[model samples]
Target: MKNIKYDFKSVIDRHNTNSLKWDYFDDDIPMWVADMDFKVAPAITESILKRANHPVYGYTVVSDELYDSYINWWNRRYDFKMSREDMLYSIGVMPSISSMIRCLTDIGDEILIQSPVYHVFYYVVEDNNRKVVENELIYENGEYNIDFDDLDEKLSKVKMMILCNPHNPIGKIWSKEELSKIGELCCKHDVILISDEIHCDLTDPDVYYNPFEVSSDYEKAITCLSPSKSFNIAGFQSSIVHTKNSELLEIIKTQLHVDNSDSTNVFATTAVIAAYNESEEWLNQLKDEIFENKQIVKKYLKEELPIIKLVECDSTYLLWLDCSALNVPSKVLSGFLRENQGLFLSAGIDFGKSGDNFLRMNIACPQKLLKEGLGRLKAGITALTIIK
Candidate 1:
């Protein structure tokens, strides 16, 4: 077999494709979005092409073979076995969260979430007229941990909890012990756990991803998985909601029909099948590249820009920069980076109240671009220090 070469140095122009990362600004380097600057796997490209060759695009149902691909992939990658019957198809994790919230909980019910999480979690709860119970994560020793004591207190009123596994922004691959504690608490409180494992596949080889439902205590939970983040197929909009709870699954499916959300495009299924079936080699190479990129950021921050520190991360290509030492508001820092440094990143405040003085940088670009962005950041920080 030929070794797959994951070259992350070839910069491609993505300016005119109406991409949110590229088209949002003129002549700005977009390191804000989580999407990577890599081409889709050859397998996925070929599969889409094969499907496109069919002259007539007609209504289609998800094939059993596609479902098996997911089951097989999970078993092999995460060592978590899932039954075909337990899988439910969805457009994406966010939509599934919205639909699950609407279906499983009543209006005015409370939903719990950890602050400084994916910002959309707040909106997903509030948009459905549910109360958001914020349990802020504890940041100490350069890592973020869930406040289980506070979570226990909040669980009294919360009917559901949305968890981002291999968490966004900070890129934490939550330990099994941590997940066990959460599962025990949620089970005791009878809170429906909605674990979003969308970034599970992005983990480094040494890190472990404990699927919430993989534990017996957490079998009552629902897990959201997708090929979008791992395969760079976000535009395709394909995701799966896995659950062992038959009753909850029925409720979700029924509500999806009632809400007119029980349909998916043909391309999504095609892409998912190809991604899960034949993209492992590409994925392994991508993970290695991301790991190297992450080290580059860490080394640069520690040696070159001592004031700007990176949060601990074991997964995901996002690097959370702690700019608290700079003593500047995150938005101002973001603006300065974009205007003065030509670097764009997501402001910390956008994540939540706890994310102040932090900035999220996407390191999933070509190594050259990643280096340039880091160089600009280092230079910008140096200038700031000199001015101060």
Candidate 2:
């Protein structure tokens, strides 16, 4: 057994603490939400404590340290260099994305997204009154690929498109060739490209996450990211948006103003800086735990629940489970797991129609909790089979 330096072996109860994942049910173990169960890095907690001790919790703003931290992290980790001028801060990635959507497209204009994506992208597109034009991914042989031919056709009609690299739910890290093809189609069709690279840092070191701005094909693209996902600081709501397009940047700023999503919470700036600047070692340790959890799921499913297939995940702690072999709908299966087995997993249907017989399970937790969840899952699926 490999020695893990992190405290991923112990179970920590988050119940009754306003934790979205744990507060849902008293008995149900939530392997649903993307948030993790581990305590944040020491640097992050120290930074927040230092801020909390300060006399004032007044209106806060972005600083050179905040921008510099983000810029430095990207350059240091991914070798994607950018000036402070290229980065813009927003309350959160969703807010930034929603703001950009409003600014880039007219109501009823189409926004393209690959289906079985992050469920929020669907809401951000439709809740803003824009039509959802889905180029559903092709899932076969336990792998997923973009249907670029379909995407190319879809691009002709949509005015804007959002791409999720190191994708949520599916946990796919998009390759440069694949991304360039999409960029080419978007640019050729005059579509505003929005790349959400929030899961970029969660991938293994060798896996390359191509930031849109780094590619000449995606020169006109707008990329949004945050340390929230990578650092487990989603509550801070700090996000960064970058693009070389000056006009698009101005439009995004105007929309952010209209939405009132430009300012940071008092501690967000502090959290971002601490996470990016001082927590790389912590993050590397976190990724190891995440990957270990993935292995647990893979081994458990193969040995205990042979019918369920774990998708090939390159990034993110979220594991996409293919329950198609169980011959149950995702909604029905998810509900069964919650009700019968005390296991709460995200219903795949919420992502899109392409997500049939699939469930997205959050594995960023103590190994003990993951093992418990896996046991419950086997029981639920077995019960379903008996019912049939």
**Least accurate 10 contiguous residues by lDDT in model 1:** 1-10
Q: Can you write out model 2's per-residue Cα lDDT over 1-388, one digit (the tens) per residue? A: 1343556667777877888777756557888888888988878999999999998999987888998988888888777887887778898888899999888889999999998999999999899999999999999899999998899899999999988987888999888788788888888899999999988889854565777667545667988989988989999888989888888888898889898888888999998899988788888888877887888888888899989899988899899999888778899999888889889999999999999879999988888888888999988888889999
Off-target runs (Cα >4 Å) in candidate 1 are: 386-388
Cα lDDT over the full model 1: 0.86
Tens digit of per-residue lDDT, candidate 1, span 233-293: 9998888888989999999988766765666787888999999998888888888889988
Global fold similarity of model 2 (TM-score): 0.97
Candidate 2 regions exceeding 4 Å error are 1-4
| lDDT score at residue 151, model 2, on the 0-100 scale | 92
For each of the candidates, give the backbone clash count.
Answer: 0, 0
Candidate 2 backbone collisions, by pair? none
